[model samples]
Target: MLIHLAYTLTGDRRCAELQRMDSERLDMSGYAYYENIWGGGAESMFRRKASVVQHLDRLRVGEHSLFEIDDFIVNGGEGPGQQDEHRRLFAPAVDLNFRRFEQDRRAYLEGGAERQADEEAALMRWLPHCRRKLFFEWNAPELVNRLIPFLYLDTYLSLLRAERSTIEQVRRDLVLGLNRAFSHLYLTDSDNLYVTTQYLHSAEQPRPLVRLTIPLSGVDLFVDGRPDMAYDRERPDLLLRFAPPPALALRPGAPMPKLERWRLNLLTFEYLMRLAHGGTYNILADECELSVRALKDQLLSAFAYEPAEAGLIEFFVAERRRYVLKKIQIDEQGHLRSGG
Candidate 1:
């Protein structure tokens, strides 16, 4: 279904390759739905708890589970008209939940801790049934937008096992992750943006000012427009307060605004590791007609040290080698830092 949707959206025949790749990646089941469900389950649960994070096809009404409705449509002893009628029966409830979901989403974004907690609880209570709503209404513009943030948030939350974290901590992580996601989307040329703790500055004289932008690209709602980095040409001084970045101070219900070059977040690191260790990188190297070492050097430039920044990137490299490649053992302690 998703591959069909992808092909429909992009009209690219290559989208069919996703099916082939997914099949290759999975076991004899010939499908990856279960692995995806289990592998990303915590992230999905966290995103759902955080906000309404689902596409239209995934939406459910109270008590009328998707599977039940799907069965109804397939074998409800009903004709097309009857199935349409049954589907419409749940439409009002779905609409109501959508409105409420959007309202709570706005409240969570605009409200403080108390309001956020209240909304979270309300949404949690609404989950079992609201998640089961079934309908074919594609009227909601925000559905697709809601879906994107769920995946983007996982880029950060999964690394830390965010399900165990406090509400405040989860919100903080979401804010940071969303910023990282939109920054990459608006600023970089690559689809896979490598977000790192490291920062870079230009060496040219009278260096052009790079505005730190916080683009909320469908953070919880569908943003109709794209981020225009050209708009930031006026506010170069925004770089001074890069610590939190402007996304932290964005007013409630603020519009999406619009990076620097070359960053590497942990998500990208893990992906690269999997590719290299799984031999995918070697296949890519072979296909590209480039030496593996040469291919790696091209990517390594993003992690390389610049004269302006500290050696944090170097520290990351060393630690990755020690803990990952060498599996070095450290002196165990009783604290949280200690090896369990």
Candidate 2:
């Protein structure tokens, strides 16, 4: 899957020469593109949207009128799930200004609920496919595209080719293991070892959370040189994490790589897969405690050596994007073939 940004002006404007977005305000962007990672902002917040489109008078900058930006909407899908996967994505451009005056007139009638009801009825009357494009679009990721840096295209393409196999394995690991781990991380001991992705300090407390954090080297927990019985107990914001095995966990470096609180499924999958593979490929992280250095180290360590070009990276993870190896057959000699 791919995601891109589009912008348009909305809401009522009294004059032509409207102000542009401020740099500092735009700097405080709340974009969420990495579904597997929760970095506060919109991820922790609930979002609400209105279907109605906003209309504004033409913007004017000095004598000449500002460029008019029309609302654009796009919606399209293709083929069956089992087919050749000739899928296409279109963000379909639709114009919502057609009935601007009419909608305005309807706005005041009978408190406008009547017109709203009529519009809904009329939409229901039309062919279902026709209404797919009419939606009030809002994507925080797209809003902050201005702040996103461009990739070193040549270097990225080369690296993609060089590490295709590693990439494929990662995809498979994530696609198959994430949800499976989420369902079972708590089953490690059942009687103890709980995890909570919230805030609860371990410095000092009256009833301190009995959170067991396993380090990379240690297999057991000891409190004052004695086994700590992690009995089942109630504690708010408690988190039990199986910390990365030292060699596998990257140390924090400067110009830190920004990471988020682990999305539970991804975190669990990382741990379970590491256990299964007899090696760890990740580091533990807490929500609201992201380190840019750790992120940079993880990527560099994955390659064993640094590349020449500066890379631009974006995390894209979605459960719905799982892969299917359809119509494949394995030969007796351990060869693979596409059957269908």
Best by lDDT: 1
Candidate 1 lDDT over 211-326, as tens digits, reads 22223331221112224475643321100011223433344664432212222333343333334233233322332323222423443332322223122121111232331111
User: 193 in model 2: Cα distance from truth in Å?
Assistant: 13
Predicted structure 2: lDDT: 0.26
lDDT to native, each model: 0.32, 0.26
Please list all clashing residue pairs in model 1, or write none if there are none. Answer: 60-132, 60-133, 61-132, 61-133, 194-263, 195-264, 195-265, 196-264, 196-265
The per-residue C-alpha lDDT of model 1 at residue 47 equals 30
Q: Which window of ten consecutive residues has the lowest lDDT sum in model 2?
A: 52-61
The superposed Cα distance between candidate 1 and the true structure at residue 336, in angstroms, equals 30
Instruction: Please write out the lDDT profile of model 2 over residues 59-143, one tens digit for every residue.
Output: 1101121111111111111236312211111221123223432343234333456567765454333211222221122232232
What TM-score number comes out for model 2?
Answer: 0.17
**Worst lDDT 10-window in candidate 1:** 235-244
